[model samples]
Target: MWIIFGILTLIMTLLNLYMYNAGKNYHIFMVLSLFLMALTLCDQYQMIASWSLAGDWSAIADVAPTLSMILWIFVIGSFVVNVIPLLLSYRKNR
Candidate 1:
């Protein structure tokens, strides 16, 4: 599941980069996508370490999950913000 998510985020980051270069006003999406990719990588690392060490999860317990959760919140918030403008514009046009 993590691998699948990582792949999906990787694709999103790539698409954002493409959109950013193709035109204007996509900088925020690109930046957020990059941030999400970084967070996903960090989460993957933490998961690997936790699995390898088995009973030593305490070492990363203080920070990893909390930071990941915070990043997820930001990612979701940004997605909502990005979608709202488009939805409003579509509604206005209709």
Candidate 2:
């Protein structure tokens, strides 16, 4: 459920922050966040598709499109935050 997703996301975010602050590679956690977000979106899409199959128009209507948009934003934001430092560090080391 969303509660589980929230907890996992929170843990990942904390790990990412710690790694970032320590100047360690945080790309792995960013990748994990992207994977998690994709999985959740796919699951949500499947659920919505099932609702349509069941002729439950109301269920589809109830799904806020903004929710998925928000997820996309967060995943993309994580990539931006993690990747810049990773690239910068790589270049500096080289």
- Error in Å for residue 67 of model 1: 1.7
16-76: candidate 1 lDDT, tens digit per residue: 5556456556556656665665667676677757765786656567656786786577567
Compose the digit string of candidate 2's lDDT tens values, residues 15-68: 776787798878778677656666666766777788999999876776757666
Alpha-carbon RMSD of each model: 7.1, 2.6
The alpha-carbon lDDT assigned to residue 52 of candidate 1 equals 57
lDDT of 1: 0.62
**lDDT score for candidate 2 against the true structure:** 0.69
Which pairs in model 2 have colliding backbones?
A: none
TM-score for each model: 0.43, 0.67
User: What are the lDDT scores of the predictions, listed in order?
Assistant: 0.62, 0.69
User: Which candidate number has the best TM-score?
Assistant: 2
